[model samples]
Target: MNCKSLQPAAKKCVNEDCELHEKGFAKYFCNICNLFDDRPRPIFHCPYCNTCRMGLGLGIDFRHCMRCNACVSLADKDHRCIPQKLQGSCPICHDTLFNSTEPLKGLRCGHVMHLSCYNQYCRGQNYTCPLCMRCMEDMSDYFSLLDQAVRMQAMPAAYQNTICNIYCQDCEKTGECRYHFVGLKCTQCASYNTREMGRYEQLAAFPN
Candidate 1:
């Protein structure tokens, strides 16, 4: 059988372990495995991924997440797991996360994204997971403040009964809510950033 089309008219290896032995092509045959190639970086063959991945066992600051099927930073070893989370595009920038050379950051929600993209997203005053809409950090204190402000009716009565179209900074969803004496809550994520598209109206108090 002629195995000419496998690689080019290159040198052939007779070793049975060599991948090019049966194919009859050998460019840079490894004496051990006998396969064509000049690998530059430290390529670590992942048995799980069934492929060679660069930057392993070379003082690389990352750990392979078996659940995500990708390498995440060592700092994120304790991050939550979302099965096959890193297999697709990032939720923040919608860019492919796998095999990317950019710096990646794993969220508490088990999602990962480009570090720069995540920084820019948070710079826009959002502090929640873009995919799950869960608070990235514990904001129970802030929520308590909001709750207190509502109980005390700290907002001026002039703002009462106002109709506001709220866009949640956390969830990126929109809804309309009637203004109260304190804060307007988003119907979607219940976030208090209901400051968008506000319209004032004179809603009279209901008679008891």
Candidate 2:
């Protein structure tokens, strides 16, 4: 079997007579670099990561983040830094993230997860990071729509003037807002992704 033809293939060589047929042909094989290589892009061994990675070589298309202990794309150079963010598994699927072959995505909260998992998670209407409970993307437009909806529907008379102590997951702040069955808006960031802590009281109860 011609080894050149299998240079770009990731599957094992099927030539029955070939000695290495069972071993297969790896496009990114580097005998001197590492024993096993499965990365999609051009393979380069990262000393800090102690494994093979796909990129234009370190310091070119990627850089090793000491804090995260992983190689990150140059495009994410200015991303929010989280301590040992890549050391954990994907929050959605619980798959290892450190050496995963799948594409990784960085959340706004500085958490990391598999790109595919992130897509599936978002399709479920979950917009927050699983670990931090913070918004994964800009939710201002969605929150604005919720604001309009809240304004259009008045609360029932029994619950009117009632307030709730809430915690804003996006801004990580605590404040009070008028209780609504739809959602509670944060007083600080105007975000509706809040959790009700407890009821404040009806303003009419202490009327002047």
Whole-model lDDT per candidate:
0.64, 0.80
Q: What is the lDDT of candidate 2?
A: 0.80
lDDT of 2 at 38: 51
Model 1 local distance difference test score? 0.64
In angstroms, how far off is 153's CA in candidate 1?
4.8
Candidate 1, position 111, lDDT: 74
| Weakest 10 consecutive residues of candidate 2 by summed lDDT | 3-12
Best model per TM-score: 2
Residue 179 miss distance in model 1 (angstroms): 7.9
Give a tens-digit lDDT track for model 1, residues 43-105. Answer: 454456554445453136556678777765565546787888767897876888875657777
Candidate 2, residues 70-106: lDDT per residue as tens digits? 8888887558888888778888889998889899999
- Candidate 2's C-alpha runs over 4 A off are 1-27, 31-40, 204-208
TM-score to true structure, per model:
0.49, 0.78
What CA root-mean-square deviation does each model show from the true structure? 9.1, 6.0
